[model samples]
Target chain A: MVDPEIRVVTIDDLGILRSVQEDPATGRVVVTITPTYTGCPAMDVIRADIRRALVATGHPDAEVRTVHKPAWSTDWISDAGRAKLAAAGIAPPAPARRDGVVPLTLAVRCPRCGSPETEQISRFGSTACKALWRCRSCAEPFDHVKAL
Target chain B: MNGPFTFALALGDDSLIAAQRLAEWTTRAPEMEEDVALANIALDQLGAARLLLTYAGELEGAGRDEDALAYLRDDREFRNCLLVELPNGDFAVTMAKLLVLAAYQVPLYTALAVCPDERLAAIGAKARKESAYHLDHAMLWVKRLGDGTEESHRRMQAGVDQIWPYVDELFTTWPDAPVDPAVLRPGFDDTVTEVLTTATLTVPQVSWTPAGGRDGVHTEHLSYLLAEMQVLHRAHPGARW
Candidate 1:
């Protein structure tokens, strides 16, 4: 199912959907997901959507387990998902910064004009998953999926 | 006090209270983006609180769940440090509080990430990443406001001084904790000092070491905060959205 927020990216494409184990014999299914953020409000909706999808596929007994051992990272977003996000006017995240270094962002190319002349408007946006940015080239405001 | 249950409860209470305090900034922050930022940080704290409280309840082996532990408890039952329970004084004060809270949490969670407790470790492994972000955000604001202008610098310093006395309570010894609170002090000091120095703010020097939140002795502010927070649940028990 597509992400309830972004709408253009599927759960698989976003990689929050960790694994799905299904038993054809008993029609039993177990799905595991790691939340993009520990406080992500989307998890409940995503779980419900997964259950609905499973029921539609004839897997009536399904277990959706949430795990946190291996934390979620923006790097998990697939390349195709990035493409879909850019196509939808939302800038995909930059490479996940490592070693806890405060990333010095040199540039964020405007999704609309592909020019590196974009400025961050705020460190936060409409949702926890993205930041607000303004494109200098196109003079358009956009959301950038923040790198965590 | 030695039980892991109380240890987890204390940690949970810290996050829960912090979340509630941050959430108070919703619709009231100085700017629209700040409103969203505080709300999101509040959500993160709430998220971590839920996991810790759930684990604490399980460890207690009592009938209490996260909601029961959270909603049914009164101020005296809460284990959050006074720093979190204090009223949001001003924008600078709020940022100062966030700076210290996130500074402490990052090291605490990072230490928890490698601790022997599997569940806490999992929670920590996930939470440390988020705490790092929170810490970064707070540092940015602290430095900006601390060094910005004459009035801004004065207010930021005052904010740090106002919140400083309560800071010592967070690092008191907890022998049964996954990572003893004392052990986390050095890291916390390092992080806070650097940010404060860069921000042109002093790390307030205070002789008063008021403590005892672990044993559920909180300040008067907690009672009022809990009255507002737990009122809905107490009025309509077990109500859900």
Candidate 2:
């Protein structure tokens, strides 16, 4: 049987795995997920993917549930996901600041050239979860997953 | 309606109306990037509207879902402020309206995040983050247009003036609400002032204030906006794409 984490990560790019447990009697796996953002359209896709992956991997009766408690933060993205995002030329979000002060400027390092000198082109990027940025060093435009 | 139900409907209507106005800019924005940006913002608002309306339906103990509340209700049944229902006059005007509305939403959601209602608090926590981005986007535009060329600056100022009269309506509140809108005014003012100052613009001094959207009294623009938004859904009646 494939590991549940690998199966779930195949679909959840945000790395929002909260919990996975098997029912002792039914032997059915129940996966719990927390969304990256409340209005993220990717959520439906993620849910469908999880169900498909689990069902295809011999767990035909697996259940996926979404929870809202302890609201999702960018800090939840796994280290592996962060590396994957950078390898894909997308800057992973910085750790969320506990202090409520929102920084006027986010110093996102360019994933293309690993340069700290990056400027934000648009707050709303190609997707709701990212911000468009330009690397001053590489002169290439990229997306930075926003720190929500 | 109960307190939570009414409050949820008001929030849902605000997002729904704002989303409709933003959708009007899909292919009409001055820049292609703005076309995508406005559409994204509109989708965000639509998503929020769906959540709030769905909750409202559950609170009301009615069989009605988000669609019934959104498409079946008459203009008079909506509880959104008049500011959201106003026409998208131009890019400058749209930015001006967005500046005020987004600024208002930031503090409003922040306060609601800790409200007594657990479900509302959860929604508020997520919404607070989204609204911050919306406010930031509006601030950047307001600064660019307000401090740009002479014509752009003048138009930006005029946009502010046109929308200023309706700003007061956003601060109106009722008892037992999750957050007192009046308490959010100071934060809203400070944020707006900082942005306006950076943009080299002044707050407009308006003498007349419009109010009463919470009581179903809205500007004439809302009826037209609703007619256009609801026509398809009303015609089909439970048709799903």
Candidate 3:
């Protein structure tokens, strides 16, 4: 059974990992990661974490490469990933407009009180991928996941 | 653009000029929210430009890193397209240029993200998000300027007119340029049309076109910018923060 308590945040939950592939012939795995923003400080931590996980998982030969191109988006988060985030008490991103025709807008939900009544405190939140929002009902400050 | 030196210079020079222009708004935009917003954009461009110039230098197999390419090149040697190097005439003009550039970039990077080349796809993916945000911000401003007031409309129109010529040069990929137009669809005409329509402005078609960035030619403004951007680094040579 899937553990109910364990949380798997969206890749947006942490940040972008472009790809994770293992080469059986070489017995080497490569995990490609990129930052949400150009110089997000979390990137180093993520790289280290991936390395630790690989080593701990008996894949000591694994390599983590950070690639910055065609950059990252919040949209890459998988359906299963979003479910994990919601169950973890963190809200998930809304559906992306795949058509690229309609303009993007977000109706941020309050994570604290589960209310829709909220206000944007700033366009930039603690990080590039989030916005600072405050709950009107609970009067608590929170970070809203920006729609990429 | 003149020759090899000029082309190399242009690659770095365009980013330098464009970066400087964008940086001018640091803490000087109409509001605090926008101040941070504009600064973020400037920083993103600066970082990308640095990488591109550094890569260009490496491709040349010269010892020069990003700083050398950015700081050492002379004005006439710079080859950035005119649109980027032009004066940031006003907020309206800045917004207009941002709209055109970012709109072009979105699709450009979208195609680039999937390039068979790993590095290109990586860079394209990284740049794509920033380009999307830049385009979104520009669209918001364009709508505001276009539909706001008589003065805003006048300025917006003027801005569009001033920058129209520069648009043509962005697509003129020189024969020897590393980036191939064939790999990516040249969708400038369609993309620009949609944005202009959304902004409620008429797209202008003109025969007077500018070129030479791919060939390494640039205007007089480039030299001064290089002097300022490169001086401290050139003087110190490998100084680190």
Candidate 4:
């Protein structure tokens, strides 16, 4: 059987898995996911998607659980996911700052023109996970995945 | 009611009502970007409400789920602060109210993050991060509008003054609560003062303070808000989109 982690990653493409393991005798895959944020709406969708992916992979019964131990950080997003975001015209989040001091403005490089001269138009964007930014070089508006 | 159950429900009601008010700004905000931002913020609050309400149901050992608790409850049964139930009068009012609530939530959730209850603590940890963003958003707008044109400054200060009476209730506390509301006062005061200072706005000095939402007493606005919010759910019970 394929690893459940791979299935979860394939389904969500957010690289949110903390761990996944299958019981050898019971064939029940137990998947653990770390939520992007406490109030993130994606967690529910991700849980259902993980279950569906496992079922499609011949594991009919699987348990999807959430863990909040180390908490989720933007650093958990994989390289492939970051690339996907960039390709989709969404600037990927910068590495999270540990000091809890939020900068008044973030220097988000535009995904379209790769310009560093992007200004935040809004603190929030199309979704809670992103911020709206306008690129000076391209003069195009894009979403920047927020660092959290 | 059990301590955790009541506590969770209070927090849940606060988020749910705040979400409803925020959602109303979707098409009415001054700008398209503001509309999108308000909706995002509303969705975040809604998500938090769902988690807390679901946990509350579990703690109560009641058969009610998140939907039941959210849609089926009467206004008098809700435990949200009166500040959240007030109508979203204008963009300035919305921002001012959000600033106060978000500032309060930052410290409330931060303290709750260390509660003995593991699930509540986990929720608190996650919520604290979201509240920080909410506070930041409110702060920026409050500053911009308060320090902007004369008209903008007038509206912003009016919004602050209007909401000030409802502020005192947010610091009320009960025994066995996840975090004492009084304990959050210092942090709340500092945060609000910092933003108001930058905005060049003075805090309102109101002699009369409004209270009683925690004990299920709410302003008349709550009924209308609940009617609108609960309509579709009431129309089609058990319906899912």
Error of 2 at A22 (Å): 3.6
In order of appearance, the predictions have TM-scores of 0.97, 0.91, 0.75, 0.93
Q: Which of candidates 1 and 2 reaches a greater DockQ?
A: 1
> DockQ numbers for every candidate?
0.71, 0.46, 0.29, 0.54
True contacts kept of each: 0.73, 0.32, 0.36, 0.51
lDDT by residue (tens digit), candidate 1, B1-241 = 3478888998899999999999999999999989999999999899999999999999988778999999999888888888999999999999999999999988888889889999999888778777887888899999999999999999999999988998889999878677998988888898899999998888888998788887888889999888899899999987899
Stretches of candidate 4 exceeding 4 Å from the true structure = A1-13, A38-41, A68-70, A99-101
What's the best-to-worst order under lDDT?
Answer: 1, 4, 2, 3
Candidate No. with top TM-score = 1
Q: Best by DockQ, which number?
A: 1
lDDT of 3 by residue, B1-241 (tens): 2233334345445556676888888777887767767776776676667656766676667687776767677765566777887777889899988887776667766665675656546655666667777877887888888777889888888898888887777766544433544333347677667766876877877778876654557656555666677788788977887
Which lDDT value does model 3 have at B109?
A: 61
Q: What is the iRMS for every candidate structure?
A: 1.5, 1.9, 3.3, 1.9
lDDT of 2 by residue, B17-136 (tens): 999999999889888778878888888788778888998999999798999999999988999999999999989999999999889887877788889888788877777777777887
In model 4, what is the error at residue B109, expressed in angstroms?
Answer: 1.0
Clashing pairs in 4: none
**Models ranked on DockQ:** 1, 4, 2, 3
lDDT score at residue A90, model 3, on the 0-100 scale? 52
lDDT by residue for model 4 over A48-120, one digit each (tens)? 7778888898877899988765656677777877887788788888887664335555678889999998898
